[model samples]
Target chain A: MSDLLERLRGRGWRLTAQRRVIAEVLDGEHVHYTADEVHALAVARLPEISRASVYNTLGELVALGEVLEVTTEGGRAKRYDPNAHRPHQHLVCSGCGTMRDVHLVTDPMGALPEGERFGFTVSGVTVTYYGRCPECGSRA
Target chain B: MSDLLERLRGRGWRLTAQRRVIAEVLDGEHVHYTADEVHALAVARLPEISRASVYNTLGELVALGEVLEVTTEGGRAKRYDPNAHRPHQHLVCSGCGTMRDVHLVTDPMGALPEGERFGFTVSGVTVTYYGRCPECGSRA
Candidate 1:
């Protein structure tokens, strides 16, 4: 959105064409894309966009708290999500790499007993559940 | 530890010196070492351990279900842990990278409401809490 672009400009970020394309690619519902994926998508719109530029823009967005970086199991490539305004978890499809947002109705932090604090303040908690999707399961 | 090596060998893994040193480096209570950190410790013993070997052995260990690879908040180098027998979450110190195992008294999976399943069978869940350690807190 223009508001997001204006906020980035206010943060002293250079509003180049490459950054704009990356931002546009990331703005949507259930939009989770890797850096390389974003680069591919951005290149479709702006042919001159480089992979390094996509990586840089995604890193800056994460640092600015406008995006969240998710590293799934097996040390795969990090995925970027722009839905940082709301708190939620992810349900990833192991077969297709498709990810869907699942908002937790019960606060996961509330389950942490007081005895396990270990003198450190608990700031936030994230939960990720991995499994086969319905389509994948039917195939199995 | 000999029993573990024997089980690993039974799984068709070659018992090489590089693998031995990597296993020893990860053997202990509450030990979580990154790949480079494991390489540093492995080299101290074998002196010929390559980063590739450390990576290979770690991957093999995870496949064998003898070790767990943990990727904390954001995408960082994966950390290896030898405690595969227990069900626990991590309490990681954002400052020192110190990790402690904290058992959740409540079943977090059970807390997920039925409507949020998204038709995927949840296999497992991992929770990580990030905060400053006592030393880091005092410095701040």
Candidate 2:
């Protein structure tokens, strides 16, 4: 994802070894890693990367919309989903917390009628599908 | 929500002062409170309940399907939505984190095609509509 790094440079993001490593770890399709996972992976690549740095880098990426934060469960670690080239939703395995990206053919925004808008400038909608994954379902 | 308590009792949930107070706090329609908010309100009523009790009670409620834990935003404190008699989705305020209940006219499960089920038995779907509420929008 060097192109991502290059795009960041255009946004005036200060390039650092840790930020670059974190970005590299998060690069790729359907790559969803939690903060701790990102930190552990980055630490493996760079021995000196700090936890705070990883958090900061992730925060910056999310703020810039280069990364999407997906919280599928209650009060649990948030999984960072690499924003793919297109808009998508998440299907999560309730048994093991596994998540996959799925693009719904139906637009969810239309589901909310105008009467339900509640007068707030609507930003968008987030839908999470919960179910048992194949492995989890079979195990039971 | 005496019916909730009665159901819990039928399910063999031990009735404690703390659990009862927490249940009372959450015993209404459109009730969504964070852990801290629940604690504050419970203390106002019962004065001696610990934060741990609040947490433990909430956790037990969710585990029993007596309550629904809602994490609308990534990495933010989870808000507990008291499950109304009828199931509904949430409309959240992006600015103040205020949430309201809304029923969708369309069936969300139908939105997902058979191709996307991915061999998992689908359980349910949660939709969170976000925007500025009237107060927040007016202030801006």
Candidate 3:
């Protein structure tokens, strides 16, 4: 059983076969899939799973704060991130849009000086590292 | 004349009446507007301008590297950033989605260790700070 499914079940969320399969597909570190991709994976697991079901389940997970919708690249489809409990950032490949979870040495929120805050009450930070993966680098 | 307009002119970009109005609306240090917002502003300036024109112009500017498309909020509409030449990150309001350009003291790319890079040749980094602006904070 995936941590996501376990968490959902703990929250008294009714896990239908569709929802369960969707959660299972999203189980792992560095797992980020767009809605369509999630639908495809869920379909592979349960051939009867519908695209609308995947989208709705994904939306529910995001609304429940169990998943994160991430738009790594501008004008690109948003990716659903299942590693919501962990505190980490993303390393995105510029060439292929592949993403991986990366723990940073320093918390970016701490790096902002008071002078740069511009009168806003600061809370959190997101740091995205852009690069070429080994495959893309080798190709280049 | 705005820097963006001047740069576009320098590059021999045709400054039609519609394009000029759109460019003028986008001129600022922290300007980040979605296509709909940009269209609204452009309509205020030139009532005859169409939404498609604004989208097309924004696309061309992005392709020319004269503008940047930024997504401050996950699953939200992308914002067009005119300050593409400057090196900076974004400070976004979690409550209202307001965003401002912010400069950090340390370079984040330098903080990633070689072992943690996971075989990716990291090149750049984007750091986004999330918080509530004064208006939203006051309401809270």
Candidate 4:
């Protein structure tokens, strides 16, 4: 994750200790953590990282395109995906709120017809598929 | 919209004045309001409906599947679409936060191939297309 830090540093990001730890906690593949989760993880490392600092760092990372902020349906907490470089969709478990990153061979933007454009300059699309995870499905 | 209230009434919903006003505010076609917005409109009519009551009413409507709660990116306030009887997607204005109910010719759930199911028993899908509304687009 130092590679990401170096790149961000090269882009003029002031790498404070809290921001560094947040980057570390969110570095792995298929990892999506809410701000609370990030704060909890960051606290484990720095022990003095404030909640506001974590939130600010995460916001900065997202604004710099270093992380992607993913908002799922119905629930309040927004999750962060480190895989901003990847063009992918998300599958969220309705029961447990577990998120999995998945890619499709087909693009979803083509699903909207030209007639349905409704005069709004369309930019991008987010497709979230809801389901139950293996553990959650079995109990149901 | 009385059709919805009657259906709910037939289902034995205890139709309180607060719930009834909330239903009335959300009854029209292509209507989606955040809880605060719902409370604002409901208060204009009832003048004394509490914010908690508005939230509770909206929550019950979602639990009953009488309304659909849509959460888009970067927006903390979730909007409610009462047109839940028919299947549709959403196109949201990133600039002004305006939401429009739209139907697509293709079903988004069909886009996910079986191989990428990732051990989740998939249930449904929601697609939110982001863009600027006409006024916002023109401004830009």
B-chain TM-scores per prediction? 0.92, 0.92, 0.89, 0.96
Worst 10 residues of 1 chain B by lDDT: B131-140
| Model 4, span B30-140: residue lDDT tens | 798999999999999999899999989899999999999989998888889999889999999988888888888888888889888889999899999999888888564
Steric clashes per prediction: 0, 0, 0, 0
Q: Whose TM-score is greatest here?
A: 4
Pairs that clash in candidate 3:
none
> Best by DockQ, which number?
4
The TM-score, computed over Cα atoms with residue i paired to residue i, of candidate 3 is 0.91
Model 3 lDDT, residue B117, Cα = 88
Q: C-alpha displacement of A93 in model 3, angstroms?
A: 1.2
Order of quality (TM-score): 4, 2, 3, 1
Worst 10 residues of 3 chain A by lDDT: A69-78
What is the C-alpha lDDT profile of model 1 across A16-62, one tens digit per residue? Answer: 99999988998899998989899999999999988888888898899
Q: Residue-wise lDDT of candidate 4 within A66-114, one digit each (tens)?
A: 8999999866898999999879999999888889988876788998888
Which ranges in model 4 have alpha carbons more than 4 Å from their true place? A138-140, B138-140
TM-score of 1: 0.89
TM-score of each: 0.89, 0.93, 0.91, 0.96
Could you give the CAPRI-style class of model 2? medium
Q: For model 1, what is the error of residue B15's alpha carbon versus the real structure, in angstroms, after optimal superposition?
A: 4.5
